[model samples]
Target: MKPGLLALVCVAFLATLPPVDAFAAPAPSLPEAGYAPLKMTIGGETRCLTADGDETKSWQYVALKACEDGSRLQNWKLKSIGNARYFIFNEYFGEKRYLRTYSKASSIALDSDTSGYSTMRSWEVSNGALNDIRLWNVYSRDIGQWKTLDADPQSQSVGISIPGGTRVDVWQYGIDMPTPQFPVAGTRKILVMATHFSDETSADSAPVRDTVLGVFGTPYYEDRSARNYLMQASGERLTPNMDFLDEVDIGERPDACNASQILSAARDAARHREKNPQDYDYLFVSIRQWRQCPWVGLASVPGNWVLAQGSSAHKFWTWTHEFGHALGFHHARILYGCPPRDGVAQLGGDCTTYNYGKAPTDPMGGGGASMFPVAYQHFAGWLSDADVPWIKHDGTYKLDPLWRRGSAAQGYRIRRSDGSVLFVEFRRPSQPFETWWGASPYVSGVTVYVVNYAPKARSMTSTLVNTTPGSGRSMGDAPLLPNHSLDDTLSGMRLTVTLAHNDGAELKVEKLPK
Candidate 1:
């Protein structure tokens, strides 16, 4: 070989295996000044905290590496509230240096070096931090104006998407409410319920009486622990089982329509199927706030149920509709985030479209005996072909295969006393993307593609997606590993997966995701 050619070969080989530092970045330097122990009471505790570096910014907790060995203080951002009022810290999941032993809404604080633990405040954190240390801006640019909550009233509150770090519990509903605050006025996302109530076998007659705790927010749903409530209208006993639609005890479901009897059944629905936040599909339970109108019944999350005073029967729609919101769905058929067009109409708060199944006839759409109305369609299930465009365009549900493959899927089923509702979710691994907009669009749980995706590999973590850079995310369905959704349940509806492998191989799935 020519001498120059051999030299080039050596250079190429060396380039492929650069110095160890090639993959390493500089460690954040500590401030010249010595640090001290600091302490702040959060919720109501005097924990101890230590910091090694001088605070980079005041009233703003920028990157604060806890004063522990191998901590990622400056690495993780921190917002310092005045006089260290709220040492808002941002720690990702599994970053041992940024470990959290408590839930965000519970009692907790950051360990400061100066005095002790910092004061307890609702410092936000994400499940999968992605090490995205970017700080949260002042205003929250949620999807619709319905999130406005009149602005100023909500200005002082933290604008967030991820539910990690810390959160202020403004309400007192039962277990499995939003697990966080309800924006301003104790209401987050507003929803409108337009449905036809069931009549013959199922009907929730008594209007759900609500005891709103105004400044205290709404009481949690889990606060009530009855096995199930009888639906006074439908005469069905709502069961507790938010795990999956299948666990609904289909065998014992009693079908009937009555006033007091259905009201009693409603109890079963509310208590059933609420999962803890640790579950993968935990995000699916967030409920906004609702209003009551004569012709409309409203529902919101966390645990504040509202019903129009005119007709208790109308509340059935609100029951199901609000439950839909808890799982991240707006009105069916309505064009949202996207501009309105033909077939779509702006209903005071949420948008609506006229393209759904015979909503007046479907039980879920608020249809049944004792009462009669249009039915709702099977619109809130796994992502459908028609829903993919919007899911990818708006990021409601992600198509990133990285998260799909990295984390396991978690499923849940929700129920109210009036009747039970079935659902499935692909939850974020551990703590999901907790950054402002970094969260995958799977807000209302996730719309997993049950068909048409197969990838074979030696288990690798490629740069599948990174949207925080303000770049449009890659467009492609997150690989649906085998038949997760299909095998998990049994229904008459047949599922077909036209899977395509990453290695230029076509595949088909007759199974489900494990």
Candidate 2:
């Protein structure tokens, strides 16, 4: 055979074989510098990333919308600027605007500038499971940590979130998904596990076990336990069953507070005893005091796990507060520093200061192990719709003590003009719990709270209206006493506590002329 014919035969054989790079590692499916829909699958439905309102406008809201083909607002342009960072822009508006995140608001919006490093415009894109991708703002990274870009399928909104647990969903680029649903109701099983470090020989398992059982198992209504507090707070909607796992030694020296490692060990120990941790709805881990940990108690927001360090696990306020977080509740906040008209601090005025866990009558506010505020109870779906009616007309309504089950109104919901809600409830000193140090004027009065309904918000969503502002009074005295009135200029409504007694209180809701 001729030499040229033999060479041609070799070339033909090489063409018949697969490409070399195909056998090598497949290139990452992450978005390159191109146009595509940033999609996420939530609740079995596909939602496409979309910019709300005018595309050319700056600071337009960004969210996930129903997937649609050929929709300009749904299409995003990924422009790489090296180092896995990208400047994302809406294809409808081109490069004039880019996706930006506001850390304070935990929101994503469109911006015009592209010069800042990671302040807003720059986003770091990394590969997730399979075709999924995770986005983090460089500014958040510079601030020591970054939250995940999470989506609420029910609300059709997207925001930055730090999940309460190890599990989280990463956005899937170029993939389509559907919408989703709600959480479980009624009885939820709770598992309590105690752990101690190898160096802590003084850590006793007996008292710790008793404390755990007392906090969750005690059935007496007068007992200051999470079970009793939640039962009253939930109006019997939620009944949590408590299960105790024998204490385990994690065999680790507490050099630093590593929650993940501690929780993993506790879960493994439960499995070793033929108990599956996943069988319970909530997991509570109690650990001995370690100086290395900066926090006494910690819990995942809207998550199922809670960690309590030291003797705090035994305290009613500490463990109950952590459990509140697991139930999807944020801290009860007090709004301060507002100009006072008459006697009340005008909440509609320029109130800038906010103090968390300052409302002294509610457990979520770091108060005694009392029932949660009316707003939180309402959020938990514990309040009946008939009991908490929306105030539409000016009228006097009787509000029973928030902790008691009664025929009178438990709370009132007033919708402000800006779409936010104002919840009004009466509080009185109850037995075992709701008994703070100063119980005279603070614990027994009509309390009002402005609740912003943002399901994905990480900050304090409820702000207590300070009835007695600039009086050098603490947050404990924030509730409106009998015969006192509050004029909320923002809501165009005036609330006056007409009468008060041991049974309940009378509130007058009058609408101001617009």
- Pick the TM-score winner: 2
Note the residue pairs that clash in candidate 2: 45-177, 45-178, 45-179, 46-177, 46-178
Each prediction's Cα lDDT score?
0.22, 0.64
Clashes of each: 137, 5
Lowest summed lDDT across 10 adjacent residues in model 2 is found at: 5-14
lDDT of 2 by residue, 260-325 (tens): 678888887788877798888778888888777667777655556778877777775676777766
TM-score on alpha carbons, each prediction: 0.26, 0.62
Any idea how many clashes model 1 has?
A: 137
TM-score of 1: 0.26
Candidate 1: tens digits of C-alpha lDDT, residues 1-514: 0111011001000012111212111222211222222222234532223223434422222221123433433223333232111123323211112212122222222333323222123132111111111222211211111111111122223222322334322211111110011111111222112112232132232222221111124233221111111111111212222222111111122343221232223334334444222332211111112122112333222122222323432333434443333222222221122122231211112222232222221222222111110011112212121222211011112222211322221222222121112222332222211111224332212322211000010010001111111112221222223231222122112122232222111122222233
